[model samples]
Target: MKSSNFLKYTALLVFAIAIGFFAYMVNASKALSYLSHDPKACINCHVMNTQYATWQHSSHARDVGCIDCHLPRDNMVNKYIAKARDGYNHSVAFTFNTYKNAIKISDDGAKRVQENCISCHASLTSQMVKNADANHNYDDPSVATGRRCWECHKGVPHGKVRGLTTTPNNLGVKEVQ
Candidate 1:
């Protein structure tokens, strides 16, 4: 009876240790996220090779990784769901070479990103745009609603901060003459 009791206690202890280890890993991951970004994480499969090279050469390379601009912040549960869905979709696409068949982004992604841009740039909204004259009209729905920003800023790392990110391979609608 004593031997059996000892065995059960040992099993319980092992289970507790396993749970602790998992918790430790989760906690450690939050810190790791801020330390560095692995660009290879984006290209873990075949779907990413095209944008992969262009992203590497962009001025956005200096700072602001892919996640910084694209993945908008959200509540914990929503964030978890978003990350899981993205991971699953990317994995399947990579496995099947579906990224080569990637379609142009629909309006959904852009609209979501427009909200994030507003959140980040809220400080600038009240300030007049650099070239605005006193008589210039200012209440356009596009600017007020953040839609106007995307017209000229559709490329990665938006704004004139770095201009458009173009690779030697794709420079224009036709070709980079």
Candidate 2:
């Protein structure tokens, strides 16, 4: 009976410790904030400070949040799925310092951003769309087959120059509640 009691207490203690560690990590990383629409959440890691700062000074800053240009708008399920996937990848990269000094979007993320660019400015791009090649889908097996919006408008929101050291004085961003 004493051994059984000890086992039960030990299990409970282990569970408690696991829960406590999880809670601490979540809070420390601002994990919950990623679920919100606030742009400040993007700055949770120092690696993203440059991106967050460059975006702040862009015209798109006045109109859209990070997820607006980055994630899919098809449905909540896909949105959160992409968010969770990207969040996991980002956390892993940031934790291990595996990300590049000049951060670039994943292929899937680039596709999403391209789709969003076309979607948001469809009216303006209608002529180009009509003139595009018959096989010019954004998902063409070869990326060289078609043009991406950023190819010509590289400096739209993120600016022409980008790197970890590019925006040294970018700490002016105020946190959102």
Tell me the spans in candidate 2 whose CA falls farther than 4 Å from its real position. 127-145, 161-177
User: What's the count of clashing pairs in each model shown?
Assistant: 0, 0
Q: Write the per-residue lDDT of candidate 2 for residues 43-121, one digit (tens) a residue.
A: 7887877777777777898889999999998899999999999999999999898999778899999999998998898
- lDDT per residue for candidate 1 within 45-137, as digits (tens), equals 434444555556556656656555445576656555655666667656655766645434435456555566555565664464454533321
How displaced is residue 10 in candidate 2, in Å? 1.7
- Clashes by residue pair, model 2: none
CA lDDT of each candidate? 0.53, 0.80
Query: What TM-scores do the predictions have?
Result: 0.50, 0.82
